[model samples]
Each structure stands twice: as C-alpha cells, then as structure tokens.
Target: MNSAANSRMIEIVHVNRTFQRADGQMVKAVDNVSVVIKEGEFVCLVGPSGCGKTTLLQMVAGLLEPSDGGIAVAGREISGPGRERGMVFQKDSVFPWMRVIDNVEYGLKCRGVPAAQRREIARTYLERVGLGHVEKAWPRELSGGMLKRVAIATVFANGSRVLLLDEPFGALDYVTRHQLQSVLLDLWDEGGAAARRTVLFVTHDVDEALSLADRILVFHSGHLVDDLAVTAERPRSTDSLLLPDMVAIKHKLLAHLGLEKRAKPLAIVQDGAAS
Candidate 1:
C-alpha cells in the first residue's frame, strides 16, 4: 500500500451497536458511525454520559463486536484483541501483587519475549515515562499518578501501534492530571517508530480532549454528532484560543442532551479575562 493508504490506521464503516435489555427493549449505544483514524493521529471521543464513548472505544479495541458494520485497523478487520492495540482503562488495571517492572513485563512475557529482552524493553519505557526509579515499587507503594505512569509504561512496552486510552487520568487530581498529560505527550513524541502509534483517547473532560486531540469526535445519543478537527499547533497549551472552541463544542453537545443555551459566555469571559 502507498503511504497515503498506510496512513489510515483505523477505519470504522457504518458501525452501529445495539444491546437488548433484559426487559426486551433495544438500546443503541452507537449509531451508523463511519470514521478514519490516520497513523499517528490523536483522536478523542467526548460527550455526555451514556453517549457510548467508552462503548465505542471498546468496539474499536475489539472487546465488543458492533451489532452492525465493521471496524478495521491497519486495513485488517478486528475480530479479537491483538498486540497491535494496547488499552489503558479508567482504573489502574495493574496487578497489585506485581511490582512495577513485573507489571510492565507481563505482556511481553505472555507474548513469549525472552526475559532479558523484556526486561530491557520494560526498563526503557519506564524511564521514558519517568518511572525508572520505581522499577521495584509495587502498585500499593506508588501514588495515583505514579501508578498511572506505570500503567502507561506497561502498555507502551508492549510495542502496540495503536493506543486506546479510556480516561487514563480521569481519577487524578488537577495537578496530577496535568503532570500525566505532559508525560504522555512527551512519551508520545519520543517513541520514534512507536511515536507513530495512532491514539484514540476517550474522556468526558472537554479541556483534556481539546488539549490533546488532533481531532475530536462528539457522541450524542449513540450517534456521532460532531467530527471537529483541531487545527492548533503541537504541544498544545490550555489557552483562550482553544477554550472557546472547546466550550462551543461542549455547548453543542449539551444541546443534544436537550439542554438549553449552548456555550456559557460568562464562563468564557471569565476564563479569557483571567488568562
């Protein structure tokens, strides 16, 4: 395939997801969505609760099959989980019993990578995420931010070309969240070949989505209500130029939830003046 074709890392074609409740009613979580995620692109899914942002991520991760349509990564259909994609969920899914290095090596070990090579890879990624000093620390010994760093290092060590982040920083406090975001961006930039990893981040925080995403996809009532490209330069800072767009998108999303008055001007005004 040409470079242009190779650039498309993921494709969602006419996808729909519906679940039958025990009460015999159908709940559609995603509706007729089609999108293409290019290689190295950072895409975020954001919307109100119950819009199926997480469900959509799960579908792309091949954890759940769409009720209709298809999802493909690197031009191949995704029927099941594979090493091509690594996922970090809302919770720190690390094994509490395992030390930090052990958790980072787990995936490589499962894949039959030699112990020496796995350790080397784990060390490299741990250092990349600023966790090199805590190689022997157990999950319980680490702070929430530290644990999240370990989880990120673990996933990156697997050498996956696509990353599925389901609100990895959702539970962290403001300072911790900002710190992790910076670390994530640095790692994403420094990964070199791995740097081309296409990322699909799901978050309810509009600021987080706006700050990190190359593009943002808004979900409303199981349908893709908006696909907005973020034309800002890389290493994005949280600034007024971006906030208005984010707030505008948030308001548009709110309207889909039957809320009135999209975009709170007072909030925007205060934020802008403070900046």
Candidate 2:
C-alpha cells in the first residue's frame, strides 16, 4: 500500500534470450527488454505468436534463463526457480495420477508442510477456486476448465508472491475462460496489504488483456514494442471494451502487432488487377 509499491515488483533489465535454430542460425527470442512491473499489478504481455511473450514469462518464472542481462524480484536477482515465484503454464499442468486435492497440495507437500495442515490448505484453495466438491476427483475425470482451476489453486495455495502465468486459460472455451478470469480477479483482489502478489500474464488476446490487466506491454519480433496502461476501472468485464479507452488500447496493440485492419486503396487494387 506504500507509494513505492505502486510500482516496482519484477524488474527485467536489458534481458535477452537467444537460441540456435536447426538451420544453425542464431535467433534472439527476446532482445534487450527492460521493464518494471508494479506490485499487485495485473500486467499482460501481449503480442503475436513467436514474438517471445512466452519466452519472457518463462524467464520470469525461472523456467528459462536469459542469455544476457538479468531479472530481479524485490531487489534480489532471479538466479533460478524459487518457491516465491509460482507459474501456471498454457496447458493444464496437473498430475494425471493425483487427485484434485492432492494436486493442490503438491507444492505445500514439497515445501515440507505438515500432513494435516497441507490437506487443510489444499481444501481451502480448492474451495477458493470453486472446486471444493471435486477434491477427490481424478484429473482425467474433470473437464478442461476444472483442470485449470486445479492448477491455479496449486499456484496460489503455495503462497507465491509473484505469479507468472503463460496463457493459463488459453485452452478453455469462451464461457469457461470468462468465468475463470472473474474468479482470478476475485482471488487476486489487490493482493491484500501485507502480502500482495503481483501478476505477469502473457496473452495475445487484446480483449483478455483489456479485461484483466492494469497495464499491457506489447511484445513483437523479440522486442518490447509498446507499453500501454489500461485506465479502465477494476471489477472489469469484457463490456469495458465498449469504452473509448479500451478501444484505443486495442487499436494500439493491433497496430503494434501488425494486425490492424486497414482499407485497401482502390487505385492500387485496380492497377494490380489490370497488370
């Protein structure tokens, strides 16, 4: 709640990631990206496919290393994976062998929480994500949406202060996606006072960012193309897209991604056809 926390959670300073293609060419998946996300901010990394949005989020999650520069959280360098940074990937990363409650408590157990306490914590988080009744259900038994809820519950239940999500709900249907987005907002509520968890969400969907993010960082061609602030008020829904501010943000993102719709000049079309 302090002024300092109104900004500055995760800092990616001049970060870069490079890879060697099968053709023996060096490609920079991410290039010289510098950004500081505010604490408790719902920030989205928006961009086209292969633009390195996922690469950057994985770096933040410590699942991948930056080839140059560094990423730090709360002033400490991110050397490797830490318990404080939790990640939810695009696919449902649930353990198919584990039941819903067991999956939720998996992190807690790994961290050495006591048996009874871990179970209670798992149940609590399951309830939080509206899957309490399915605690004993297997992963295969649940629908796609339910599996994602289990993954989300596991991340939050682990008490991670920085949530790094790479299209966590990307596989769900429209109805399920909206439902879970609202659920996430309710659970992430300013992250509370003493323990505010910051979120860095990666998505190519403009409407998703508009509905969920406080800021949208547009990534393209392995670079940070634009940084836009979503001024829309919270408790936001897709209806906010009707607002001029939301429309402008969407336009900016599309234009940056080279996805903007434009009118074709009649002269050019006629000349090409004639030729």
Candidate 3:
C-alpha cells in the first residue's frame, strides 16, 4: 500500500463502550477494540445479533460516546456528529413529508448551501443512484429500494468523506437486497477512486460482506475477533476467490458461538457448481 493508501481514515484505539442501567449496573456493550481503516477502504463488520455492531458503528459516527479509549477520523478525535461522516440505517429515515429532492438537499441546506448549488448536487447524486425521476415523489410513494437509494444519495450529496452503513439493506427482499448491494458497490468504487471516501459497512449476511468489503472484521460478544483481507479484484462476482474465504470465516464465527458442530454444514463445491 502507498503512503496515501496506508494513511488511516478512521482509527479506534482501545475503544470500549458501557451502558448504565437504572440500578447503576454497568453493561459493556463493546469491549476493548482497536481498528484502523485506511483511506478509501471498504470494511465490513459482521457478527451475530446483539453483538454490538451497531453500537460500535455509532461510536465511530459520534452518535454515542465511548466509555473508554478514543476514536479519530483522519487523526482528529471524533467529538460529535459532523459532516465528515455520513450514516444510513436500516430504517427509512427520509422525511415522509418532503420530496425526494428536498430530502436529498436537506443536508446541504442545513450547511447553508445556496439553493442552486444544493439542487445541482442533489440532482447529480439522485441520478447516480438511479432515482432521478423520483426526485419529485415523496418517501411514502417510493418503494423500499427507491427510498434507500434516496437516502444514499442524500448522504453522498453532503460530500462526506466517510460513510457508516448499519445494515442499510437488511429490510429489503432477497432480490432487492442483492440489487442494492451492486448499487452500493458501484457507488463505493466511484467514490473511492474519484473522491477517496472511506466506508465502514455493517451487515450480518456473509455473502453481502464478502461481495462489498476490501476487508471483513468479525465481532463477537462486543469484541473484534477477526480481521480478514479480501484480495480479489474489483467488481467481485459470486465466484470470486473471496467465496471460500467467506465460507471459512462464517464457519469460524459459528465455532466462536459454540455451534459449529451443531450447525448445518455449508455446501462447498467448485465455483459455479449447482447446489
């Protein structure tokens, strides 16, 4: 990796998060975790439910403060939510009353972007996400996929250097999820190559993480368990070299949960073989 490639985009050093209950008992949501994501890198966090993946992402997004340690973006500590980091959740967060274009432009509007420039930027991103025609439609009229596209466009229009996605496609159907996966991949590739935006995507689907991430991080019991690099080329297909690696990682995660032997074995065959 070149110096620019090696430079850290997001760094979490000995980060830990704890929540206090009404009775004053402390619950550790995330344990001591250290990770360094490089500029323009696509990294995914995957683990079982309740493993604190979202909590970890929230800490990085500055939505929640950590109990210990620190998180920094581009060498500056993350104090609170800033325009430098954009986030999209599984829920459709777009304002139902606002048109798609207006919602997409809302971030810029808050930042005091002129109306003309904001419209231009929002239009460009909406088109990029294949929602150009729906700009005039309200969130209620758009399909689930279209709503997500609009949300993504909204985030991109903000000119954020980093993206934090927390299972952004989890609610969509299988086909829609796969389709959005490709769309997101294209967007990431375009943004990384052209603008060098770093992304930290959180998903539970093994294939989804394999298809999109340059590296995959496994979290278990509020701790990072593994960090595996995907060495395949860009535009990775289902038959790419990362498939076996993903399968292995999945089994490893199962083992960590003490269910490897009890779990059904994954069908492993040659690439492109019929099930």
* Stretches > 4 Å off in candidate 1: 1-4, 191-194, 240-275
Estimate candidate 2's alpha-carbon lDDT, on a 0 to 1 scale: 0.83
- Report the lDDT tens digits of candidate 3 across residue range 46-71: 88887878999999999999999888
Better of 2 and 3 by lDDT: 2
Q: Rate the local accuracy (lDDT) of all candidates.
A: 0.83, 0.83, 0.83
Candidate 1's residue-wise lDDT over 215-242, tens digit each? 8887877777767787676777756435
The CA lDDT at 31 in model 2 is: 81
Against the hidden true structure, what lDDT does model 3 obtain?
0.83
Candidate 2 Cα deviation (angstroms), residue 27: 0.5
Report how far residue 243 has shifted in candidate 3, in Å. 4.7
Q: What lDDT, from 0 to 1, does candidate 1 have?
A: 0.83
Tens-place lDDT per residue, model 2, 57-116, is 989988899999888887678888998899988987999999899999999999999999
Model 3 lDDT, residue 8, Cα: 76
Candidate 1 TM-score over all chains jointly: 0.88
Q: Could you tell me the C-alpha RMSD of candidate 1 in Å?
A: 6.9
Top candidate when judged by lDDT against the true structure = 2
